[model samples]
Target: MLDSNETIVAIASPTTPAMRGIVRMSGQSVVPILEAVGIKSSQAKRAQVIQSRIDLGTPLGKLDIAVSLWPTSQSYTGQPSAELHTIGSAPVLQSIVNVLTTAGARAARPGEFTMRAFLAGRLDLPQAEAVLGVIEAEQRGSLEHALNQLAGNLSRPLEQMRSEMLDLLADVEAGLDFVDEDIEFISDEALVERLSVIHAAVDKTRQSMESRGGNRSRAIVAFRGNPNAGKSHLINALVGREVAIVADVAGTTRDVVSVETTLDGHAVQWVDTAGIESRAQHDPLFEITAASQAHALRASQNADVRIWCVDACHDDLAAQRRYFETHDGSSKRSSIDIWVATKSDLIDSTQRQPDWMYTSVITGDGVDRLRDRVSQFVASHDKEEVGSIMGTAARCSGSLAHAATCIETAIRFVQQGDGHEFVASELRVAVECLGEVTGAVYTDDILDRVFGRFCIGK
Candidate 1:
């Protein structure tokens, strides 16, 4: 862990030419820096715009700056903190940062200020991740989600669930420790019932989280089809630009080509995958193509939406069904599936499939409808997903997923009326996983994943 005892400083505000700029500091020695720089004030939270000499010992230059102090330890980082305010200038801010670093204060790393808050019990792991979400949010829906997380919307429920799980864990472990006593603090039936409730709650939370997150944060919409089906052209038409390779050859795209755009203020990531074939011949080139298709299929399975494209001029129901079976994730994911027959200009209107969207890149038929459909799908998902899915970070979701698996295993053991030790072990895994989400239980790796990319001075 980075040393929090030593003072750390960073320019809190943008270093652009503006009316004011801020050089913030957090540590035990924060107040002393202000004192050494001739800031004498006992009042906290008040911005004292008094002129003071910023001493660097060696002559870089002298400047007058305003200072504010949080002289107590109950500040943001649970340490004495201060912010030096001056006219907004990059060189001026850089000079102040240099001076602070020179005077026993080191530069704070990305997310260090927020990480310090997390370490000091000010914010939990989910909340810490939410800080980044707020920073990276591109739309209002995402911004609202981040602000909700910051207000403890997700953390509060997770905390309750963790507290209950901790109790159950204690009971299970205690029973194991005193196996000979035949004392049942929590009955097998009761344990089974409680575990079931938690399992459902966690499952509900995970699903809701996945949906809200997938929809709000750049939801991946993948286009899967046979070779020469005009998938690239379809994407280009939708995005109003040439982003992918369009060609007449089979196996043109041996990799997933993705582009990001916004629809109705919701960020959408559109992916055009390599054309997948059902029957495979034993050739090196075919194997490579198959491998690329497999990777794209996995991505498609997780994508928020899937656009399964087929040639409009061709008639092959079996091939279409096979493609749908492999690429469509309607049952497994909180997602939408759209079957599209591309190159519609060559086909008669009577030849169109009843429910399938038929589009032609050359004639521009159905392109606007397809784009509007996709946008409506996204907007609807954003509104409806909150009921069944919540969007937490990937790390937290993975932990929740694993915890759910462990809980399921424990419930089975309890129902089987055997293997108390095995049941206890499963409970431990579930609770520990749950605890990691809230930072009640964490490793250095978990900390790194959560806070590593945070901007300095956050």
Candidate 2:
């Protein structure tokens, strides 16, 4: 539990200059400091209320400040808290913090305020972590999911699971302890059934977490093909800027160039790699070394989507198609490949249009359709709902995987008719692993690692 006596202060607003800013303080001493700063409390029948200007006399003159005082047990951190709204000027804000410090309030450390709330039982471990998630969220889907978790959506289910596990553990312990008395609290069949149900529920929760649509939707898409495929032109058209150098000369782009864009509201890192071909070694930077080829292959293998651009004006579209058809057999199943026929404006009037898209970056012809196709591919292919899944954090993933392993071992033990105590021990380990996810058991190092990412005011 946090000590109410140690008051802390921090600037609550962003560091950037703005029209207004706020400095917040919380602890038992906050009310007294507010009073000293010219805020007077008055008794009205049964309750006390502050009814004066929040700003006290300044060295130069009276400053315009808005202050709200929250008394003990009625504040966010479960302590007396005060919020001082002042001008956004950096100097003015710094002065306010200095004054607060001089008045005995110490500067708050990173995440100290939120950590205090957790210790005071105002918010649990998962909800507190959600605060950081909400702050760092880069997309709307992630923000919504994090807000849902912060509102106790995630914690409610975990609490129910924990309670169920505790009840089962109690039954097993009672059965083991009073075996000689023949109490028969839990039969072997009944124990196995309960364990099976618990395992299934945990597995379902893990799957749900993995399928949620949020952070996982963020992916990198790389454009790769043979020489003079108009990859640079396509990238520039997508981002609506001169993000990459485009030239009619083959192999103009010898390195990877990238731009950030949102496709159908999903964040994407679009990269244009050097054209792949059999070329002689020349300039070290431009040379297609074995390492460079391996790197390109690795990027293609790892990309969420690969757009294979074929220059319709020169290259044989059918040949490019055949190459990809053969390559698809050896490619990773996770990659989504698309065929793009570039420089379509130069196609002959009698030439037949292939099944692939025809795009001309110069005239912006078919660009919209290309973008639509890309969006459609992402929507149809990467349909996993990341927000409902469990493995957003490495720690959560490790815990759930560990729990699954433990449960699997325990099931084997039960099937082999092993000692009941051994089965119980494995089940206990599984429960402990789940407990780590909700921070039911945590060390100082764990706490530091979790909260260290937060800003000082949060």
RMSD (Å) of each candidate, 1 decimal: 15.6, 15.4
Candidate 2 clash figure, as a count: 16
Cand. 1 Cα-lDDT: 0.80
CA displacement after TM-score superposition, residue 198 of candidate 1 (Å): 0.3
lDDT minimum window of 10 residues, candidate 1: 384-393
Per-residue C-alpha lDDT of model 1 across residues 1-458, encoded as one tens digit per residue: 77878789998887679989999899988766766665677565543445576754445567778777777777778877888888888878888888777767889888888888888999988888778777876555456567778889888988888888889988988898888896888998899888889999998888767756565656678898878888998999999999999988887888888989898798889899988765458665777876887878777876877888888877774577575775544432356678888888887888777878989988889999998998887876576434222434566789899999999999998898877889888988888898887899988777877778777788
Q: State in Å the error of residue 346, model 1.
A: 37
Candidate 2 lDDT at 240 equals 79
Residue 148 deviation, candidate 1, in Å?
A: 0.9
The CA root-mean-square deviation of candidate 1, after full C-alpha superposition on the true structure, stands at: 15.6
For model 2, how does the per-residue alpha-carbon lDDT over 256-375 read when each residue is reduced to its tens digit? Answer: 777787777777788887777654556564445445555666667767778888887755678767876665345544466778888888987467465777789878888998888777
Candidate closest to the true structure, highest lDDT: 1
C-alpha TM-score for every candidate: 0.61, 0.61
The local lDDT score (0 to 100) that residue 458 gets in candidate 1 is 87
